[model samples]
Structure formats: C-alpha cells, structure tokens
Target: MILKPVPISAEQFTPFGDLIETGSDPIAINYGYTERHHDLASLDLLEQEGRPIVSIFRSTPLPQPVTLNVMERHPLSSQAFIPMGNQPYLVAVAPAGEFDASKIRLFIVKPGQGVNYHRGTWHHFCLALNAVSDFLVIDRSGKGDNCDEVTLVEPITVDLSDCEESTAR
Candidate 1:
C-alpha cells in the first residue's frame, strides 16, 4: 500500500494523540522574553511505577520511498517527540488496540511541530527527512513491557518526493 502524508494538525490528529505546536495564544513570561504554549500535551505516565524520562534521539533520514514493515506502541505511557532542529519528519500511526494495517495514517510534520502519541497508540519510529535530525523524546521509564510491536501483513510505502521539495534542504 502506498501512503501519502498530510500536514499535521491538532484536529486531524486528535484520535491518535496530541499535536505539539505553538498556538496563537501564548502567555508571555520571564519579563516577556519567553512565550509559553502551556499544556500542549497531557503526559500519561503514572501507571505501573512508570516515570517520565527525557532523552535526545538523533535520527538519520531514511532512503526514498520509505517502507514500513513494523509498528509499535507504548502501552504504559504516552510518547512525545519534539524536533530539536527545523527539519521536517513523517509520522505514521494507528489507533490504540488491535493492530490493523489498513487503519494506519501518515502525517508530514513540519518544523516547529511535534507529536505526543497517547498511551497504546500504535506508531512507527521517527522518520527524519532530508538530513540527520535530533528530537527531544519524552516517554515512560521503569515499566513492565511498555512496548508492543507487530509486523504488518503487508509493507506500507510512503511517497516523499513532494515532501523533499517542500522541506528544508
């Protein structure tokens, strides 16, 4: 199956997770030097002695016509990925429970946008485009089998020809 990615938005991505982006209404803090987009995502990490951990993920871009054979989910906690650079990326996700390959959705995440997958939402790993990128990953720690992976019956191919041209080179 071939998947075309659409631009990420909070409304379209609500079923799977939260779209982390700066909203128009941001509160000014630190003597107006910082504008805070508060409460963008709800971190669900309080189950089974789970604690939140922050880490930096340096991702290398995948080859053209990216194909995905497997998907995973964090059953114990939500996972959030915030890009550290202005590089764009792709996000593939399916709703929580019962892995269904046909239900998978693809999204093109532009610069200044991030994603927070709700607990149990099946998702592919970070897909950096154009070049190597870094993301601030926030997820659960100290869990009992938080990760669940399933091999797709059929691989999904993503067309990125348009994405390459649109994103920063």
Candidate 2:
C-alpha cells in the first residue's frame, strides 16, 4: 500500500484528536505581555489507573519514501506531541477499532502544528523529515499494559517526492 500525505489542519484532524496550531487568534494575557492560545488541546491522560508523564523526545529525521511497517496505540491514555521548533513532519492515523489499512490517512504536519491523539487512536510513530526534531510528549505512566502494536501484512510505502513536485510546479 502507498499513501500520500495531506496538509494538516485543526478541523480535518478533529476526529483523531486536537490539532494544536496558533493562528491569528491568540489573546494577550499576563498583564498583556503574553499571547496565549489557551486550552487548545484536551491533554487526556487516564487518571484512574495511571499518572501522567511528561517527557521530551529528540527524534532523528526519517528520509523520504519511508516504509510504514506497523501501527501502535495506547489504550489507557491519549498521546500528544508538541514540536520544540518549527519543522515539517509526517503524521499517519487510523481510527480506533479493528485495524484496517484502508482507513489510514496521512498528513503533512507543518511547522507550528502539533497533534493530540485520542486514546486508542492507531498511529504511526514520529516521522520527522528534513532534520532532527524534538517534541514535548505527554502521556500516561501506569501499571497497566497500555501499549499495543499491530504489524501490517504488507508494509505501506509513503513517498513525499510527489508532494514536493506539486509544490515546485
């Protein structure tokens, strides 16, 4: 299977989770010295069985034409990634349920954009493009086995060169 990444936006990504983007709507706060895009995403971590953990992930960039061999999810908590700097990345997601390859959608995550995956949302791991990137990760720290993985029967190939071609034209 092959997938093409679509441009990401807040509205288009709502079904999976929140899209953290600060557009032109920030309000001044803290004695008007701060611009706050407050409460942009529902940072959901399962409270009944686990404590929330905050960590930083420094990921090396993946080259283009990547192969996606597996998908994973956390059943007990939602996961979020906030990039440390402006960088483009790739995000691929499928709805939570019986794993279906046809339902997967790919997005080109632009700079200044972040994602919060709803609990149990199946997703590919971080695919940083162009350069190494750092992200602030928030999720659960618990006793339960929350992580789940499914290997695809046939790995999906994702080529971003087509995207670049369209842009260049």
Candidate 3:
C-alpha cells in the first residue's frame, strides 16, 4: 500500500520516541564562529531509465534549507545531518492504525528540530517544512540498506487543516 506523507511536530512527534533536541553539547551549537549558507540534497536521487519489466523514480523532492541550531549530539549515530528535504518525505513508518501505546509513541519534530537517521534504524522519511534542521542519526552503517520497515496496523492521514488555517493568518 502507498502511504501519504504526514507532518509530525516535535510536540507530537516525541511521544512516539524521545525529543533528541540537543542544546548543551558543544558539537551541537559550539561550532566556532560560522557564517555561510549551505545547500544540501541528502537523499535526492534521480531515476535513471525504465526497463520492460521495471520502472524508476529518482528522488524528486527538492532539498529545502533551514538553520539548525544545536546544543548537543547523539554519540551513538555516525551520520551528521540527514536532510528531510522540502516536501515531507515518507520513509518507513508504523502501519497506519491504532497501536499499543506502550510500544508506539507519537511525536513531532518542530520546525527547528531535524532528526538524523542512525545507519539502520526504521523511521518515516524526512519531513522538511520551512527551515534547516540539525539531526543526529543513530544506527549501524556497516550493514547495507540499513533500513527495514514496519507498516502500521492501519494508515495515517496528515491533517494539514491547521497548517492551512495558520498559513492564512
């Protein structure tokens, strides 16, 4: 089944997990006096060609930029900043449906918070909204395709109704 992208805010995104907002660690916001605009397309790939029995779709989502203010870092993850790109990208997510509150938690990454994917942990694709996000990924990169997935029991509908309303304000 195809899953539409949903926007998870830090406030709401955390319950599903922990708020990895680092602010006290030096690697976080301690980078020496820095001044420069950086552009990055993390997973933005291009679809090559289609074969008789196969099709291709490159990373079409254009990379969006935002300032990532940091304070600390996750020592476990090797990846630095995993781009969530402009349009919210759908990675692997819990199947859409009711789940055990004990096993699954709902959390949102606020506009300023970006999460770095550990080498192989399961997660939803990047959800870039308006600004640059500093993410501290965690996992084992030694393994190829370090990505696995868990379809939620049902499906989730991202309610952009509020964002739509706020946009008009």
Using TM-score, give the best candidate's number: 1
- Local accuracy of candidate 3 as per-residue lDDT tens digits, 69-91: 11121122222233333333323
Candidate 2: where are CA atoms >4 Å away? 165-169
Q: In candidate 1, which residue ranges exceed 4 Å CA deviation?
A: none
Off by over 4 Å in 3: 1-103, 116-122, 129-140, 164-169
**Which residue pairs show backbone clashes in model 1?**
none
Give the Å error, residue 147, model 1. 0.4
Model 3 per-residue lDDT at 71: 13
Q: Give the TM-score of candidate 3.
A: 0.36
lDDT tens digits by residue: candidate 2, 1-169: 8898889888889888889878687899999999998788787686567888989998886555688999998888899999887778889999987889899999988777899999889999898877788999988997788889999999999968667732231
Every candidate's CA RMSD: 1.1, 2.4, 12.6
Comparing 1 with 3 on lDDT, the higher-scoring candidate is: 1
**Top-lDDT structure, candidate number:** 1
